[model samples]
Target: MSPTSASEIISALLDLTAWTVFDVDPEGRILAGNDESGSMQLVEIAPDGTRTQLTALPSRCSGRYVPGTRRVVVQHDNGGDEQMQLSLLDIEPSAPPADLPAGLPADLPTGRAARLPATLVDLTPLVHDPAYKHDLADVSAESVVFLTNRRDGVDFDVVVHDLATGAETPLYDGGGYLVDAVASHDRRSVAITTLSSRPRSTQILVAGGEIATSPTTGTTGGHGTTSETPEPHTGTARPVAVTAADEHAHHIHVAWAAGDHALVMSSDHEREFAAVVRVRSGDGVPASAETDGTVWETLVAADDHDLEVVLSPDGSAMVVGHHQDGVTTLAVHEHDGTHRCDVTLPDDGVPTVIWAPDSSRFAVHLTASGDPGSIHLVDAATGGVSTLVDGRAQIPEGLPISLPTVHRVPTPDGEQIPCFVYRPAGTARTGDENDHAPYSTTGNAAGTTVAGASVVLVHGGPEGEANRLFSPVIQALAGAGFTVLVPNVRGSAGYGKRWVSLDDVDKRLDSVADLAALRAWLPELGLDADRSALWGGSYGGYMVLAGTTMQPDLWAAGVDIVGMSSLVTFLENTSEYRRAAREREYGSLEHDRDFLVTASPITYLDQLRAPLFVIHGANDPRVPLSEAEQIAAALADRGIRHELRVYHDEGHGLAKRANRKDAYPAAVEFLTEILGR
Candidate 1:
């Protein structure tokens, strides 16, 4: 076999499609998001293996089916702006139409169409502004609970919209960044989690006449006041903090349980990891009182790893996702916390589980490094797992796909950075002239050898973890004969709260130092230090620019996608609602302006030596396109080798298949040429 070109390898990997099971209807029909039509679209899969494309909007769309109804509340946004709008789509499977075209207009009429079986009704025109986001929180038979920032464009307010009367009621008008709000089964009470009180820590608030918020208050040695004014609602009752306002920083999430109870996953009680706990409102409390009696019961005790739980709608069972290292192990438990059986996954990958309406079984969406992805149906009682959707089957026969091997790189400070290494298959020349070795042959391409080069791929979020999931970019780089290293440096999540907050505020540059440490240890793994490059997007993109600028002689080339060059300018120009939230992590311009400037990659552009390729979305809301433009201009003015590509129809990242096909291949080609691969 001949050596495959970078473009050919990238294109082939990008052609693979993956779908995730979002919600399952009562009729055993699965609602999913499939990227088969060039972009992720709403899809419905019947129990008999029939798949139907629901929405064909140009932008990616996702939604949940209204409980006990054929109507689905769709959510989408324009280009890559994060202001999502809500709409209602009704599907009539019995009235199937003939030969619908591949790509339909985004603004297709609302009524029944001659070429489709779904009617899309634009709900944004009547309910909320398209300029602001109206994120769906929970949908019930009586009403829809959503959080919208339309009123002030900064604070999200919980609103309950009646499904029958079309009346919208503002349940809680608390001014803060609300994470999630869930209404009880009776819709009389609501539970919400917010980060307004403290940075990086979430406080739970229960609003209703029945349950009283906990009056416990104290400082946590962090920023902001733990005390909050009782927010008055429509009635005489107000929303109050249910969790104790103590010195410990707690990150809690809530969902409605059986009756008047709410399932809570909290990191409090002196525990380093979050644990599942059940809470409910006790009787004999006045509606206007400051303290409504509340009872708490521990369900699953905190262990060494963090836990994520999803309760079945019928309240019979729950799926517990145990987060340890970088992967998840799912287990089913009875309503009373009795362990049923641990779910056996097809591969060691990240899995997202959603319960069926009946609670008899659940759908597990599994994604691994070696395969594209697949969706499996698990029996809640027997723990039997069967494949419902297989994306691995679509891969062309004999195509090489590299699987990651977990490795830890020790830093100078003694902190070991977790990383996944993907080496090219077949024999490759080591650093020494006489040395030769054969890599793994699991996904081997015959006659292909390592290019003696490597690419360091970084994940965004600074809070996000780099797990062993299917990545076209990583696979493409490995297939092109360059080894790939995905590192979860300090400030990345999944390790614990302490690990994630290690690089906060004044310690921001420490994460970039971790990258330097990773680069220094590359030679020990038989990788060439002179041919290594940095590639990342968003915060990861910021890392790429920072690594190249801070350590000028370390990398041969760099690829930045929608990355920020200056933290000060980025925080100032970011979306208004997002500014405060991001400030908590990156530090605020109001007080830490000097530190922000010092941490910015743009501040040290004069030290940059590596050739760079910058890719950005023209309408990006998070980092802004200006971040990319400024870095590219500075590089040009300094006579540095660099290139830039801006896509007008994109936001934070490339969502469209056409743009990815164009941008990624060009980036790979640039890296190959600059590294002399």
Candidate 2:
């Protein structure tokens, strides 16, 4: 079946769940509405017609209601957090006409309710509920807008949504998935970061007139031109100044937009800086002056950072959030592109930045020194920070600052890998965290100079890599007195595409070797080369299995999280949206069967000698729970010492605070017991 015409298109198009099905009579009144989709989680309407809401809803009595249509059209799928509308259903006249609204347009579709398309509801046994397949790290629906990003290579998009009709259209067309995309003040245009395929190269694309299209779903409205290639309205898409420095400008970020200007910021991946760019119909204009750079170089290389800019709605003020060395920096800059005030931070792992509409305040996902992760709000002028989401102490008790020592370990190759390794300053054998430290019979892991126990961290995405996100999980282990090392390895993103694609098929084992090289480097840093453990979740989890099996004698224990115990199971159950991408990323499940089998960690179950902890989210539609079962059953058959923790309600990554809490301490104990101080 054609990809576009695949019977699943409707649900795929409507996947977000927040959509509307309705008909607008030629008279401009909504004659009827199908049960609101997507918005089910957002609004609760009492049987009596009263409504309670999770997000702001659009006014039903308001503007932009298309004149009339019997033909139902899906208009927006991006408005999950706010009120939205889909399209008009062509309702048949039941009786004599009432006086129509004088402002209603006369060009509405004929008066007839159309039958639902047979292909609308996908009846296939294999179908993804009309929701995003890629993990949406964040979702926003306000002012009829939705923006999202994935751990995958897909570029981020900011969609204009009409929840009333479940229609969403992209605001613009090109660039790598952006970390942030937003609209400008007038709502006449939008300013956003361009996540380009190049990863390092980014551009600012100001949309011309609506292109006669839905900015979210890209469905054409009469305002859009007939051209396939989008062009600026009047050759006005000006290339404004993006950055003053050119040190691998990978994480270009747009904090916010307002007026006709945008507050744009960029970093060297370690320092924060900005520019005030004026937006034209299709391009941007740059304001003069540049702030002295602030600290950047977050967890991994500057290239691994997600974004650095956040601006006020009117693009008047902004902040540049970045990290340098092991510290994160938050810099507040004046909108006219003048001077900036900076604050340096440590323990706040890597941060995700969001801004208040006026740019007077901002927020970040914090990874403070204590180990629990958190989300905090900050005053741009005062530079004061307050926590919104506190760190949790295991799932049972919640606190955000207690998160992990999530960090990026710079490898000898100049590449940075995600690593979580640290022991309390002088905890000796044990502390409040855990006992014996993970993988520390005597000393730290291979990379850091610290004398703590060492834990080698692996990221889940063989296509993904580790970075500086807060992890109470890592902190608990460190508090227990162990060191962790997370390697971006081969398949991680934030880097160029080639770096990510390097691990596919024939080169699968190279990552295993990369870990080995890292292992050999631990001694150089004065960390214990002997005291080390391998652990990870998802692809990272798979790394635990692969790394341990590839070099059984190299470490002490292994921890896997929703990892593929067997590549066979992974290939069979992997979500369809991810199927083609994985095949292209790794190897064909059918054609390259042998290579896949060889790469399967389950295939080498018998060689596994260390105690292992396997964790899985039972509802994980991507890597099904069966993967853990197969590996555990195999381990059981062989009488291996391995424990499995299953979270029934969670999906791919741990969502509930409780799940994260449980998973962390359990992982610590398992690793420490096997590694032995």
Candidate 3:
């Protein structure tokens, strides 16, 4: 048996198509996004497995079908800037010519030809500013609600656009990053979540009644109105406080429940993990319900694991996605907190649940280390699962697909760091089995080999988790005969809230130290200790650079993709709307500039001994391209061994297949040359 070439492995992996179902209508039609056309595009999947491509553009797109209509509200951006904008795409068929001139054949082209070609109607043309971003929140039969910073390019205000009248109304004006908002069943109320300066802490607010009027013209104006007398009222609406200001906790995945109730997955009431809680609509804040006269009911307890919930369209049942260790388990429950049945997925991987309008069955997008990604229809009643879309159909036989083994590395403290280890094909177990006890691997367990080289792949977010999801880069590295270790460091999520905030602000370097810990423990897993490299993107990229500099001797090489070299510069050059939210995690430049400077990877550039490969997106709005340029420049001036590649057509990460095919294989080749296969 011979090892697969890097290009061949990447090409086969990149060719794999993963379908993510966005919206499912009552008629069993699914609106999904798949990269079948080289970039992610919206497609409509009929009940009979018929797929109709609805969008074809240079950039990737995601959208949901407008409820009770043939229209779809598409969210897309220029290049990969992340400043998303909304557009209207009507899928309804155009009427044939009433009287064909001297045409003998009356039957026009049927099927796809009978339908009008999809064309995007730009909804934000009045405020088409790339500096600001507009994110779709919720869509009703007659209106679309979105969060945008077009007003000041800082605070995100929830704006409601009338579908028929085109009149716009500013529904809410909470002074924070309005991350999510969902409309009630009646469309008279909206529940929103706002992030404060604290990490993972979000405040939930409910704005009810017709408090604001619609504007007739300007940025707030609709595309065109049919009403003779349009109502005047287009500004920001004040919201009633649901969560108190001082009671800080992580609240997310807000959904409208039965009646005026709202379901939120929150870590409130002194809980370490988030649980689904039902908040009864009222005038007072629900956080102080025990002391005050409000009602806060815990529908689903966290039970030692963080949970995410998605309510059915009809509000009869909900799916709770439980996160334990690195894998996920989804369970269904009744609206009244009754445990219905646990959804059985194809494999133990991460699943994103999207409910059908009829609530009969829901679609689950499952992805694991071995499985690329596939959409399955799970019977809500029986928990039986069936494949709806096979994402791995294009993967050629004999392709090396690595399934990760879960292991825990002990820190200097009493904490155990979780990591996913992937070894190359045909590797044999060499170490004593009891050396690292209690480690489990998904699918068929493969023997671990004493590899000469390994790659430590870090996940971004610092607040993010490294799960058992399929990663093309990891597979490529493993195919190239390198052991891959993906560690969920101290600051990573999926653990409790305390674990996520361990490296906040001044303590940011503690996460960098975690790399050192992982490297020291690598030999126990039958991996070479001195030949480990670091690779990550965004914050993970930051980790790569930080490990190479702060812990200079720990890594042999480093690959930083859109990572921040200097936290000070990152905070200074980041988008205005992102600064405050990021400040809560990293220190603020206003007060903690010196500390941020000390924690930056660039601050220790003189100590860096590892060769570096830098990749960045020119249009990245989160971590600006300057972050990449500065580090690359510093390395060049010092005559260090390094290379930088900037993609003009991308943002934070590679979205197009062409760029990924070029970049990732090149990265593998670079690492192989440096690490020695």
Over 4 Å off in model 3, which ranges?
Answer: 1-3, 97-131, 211-237, 266-268, 281-291, 430-450
Q: Estimate each model's TM-score.
A: 0.88, 0.57, 0.91
Residue-level lDDT tens digits of model 2 in 577-637 = 3455456556777888898899888777767777788888776766878888888888888
* Worst 10-residue lDDT window, candidate 1: 216-225
lDDT of 1 by residue, 487-511 (tens): 9999887777778778888889889
Candidate 2 Cα misplacement greater than 4 A, ranges: 1-143, 147-159, 162-181, 188-307, 335-337, 344-349, 371-420, 428-453, 462-470, 481-508, 521-531, 566-572, 580-598, 657-664
**Models, CA RMSD each:** 7.4, 14.1, 5.0
For all candidates, the clash counts are 2, 116, 2
lDDT of 3 by residue, 331-442 (tens): 9999876899988787889888888766788888888887778889989998998897876675677887878777789888778898888877556564454356222322
- lDDT of all predictions: 0.75, 0.48, 0.76
Which candidate comes out best when scored by TM-score? 3
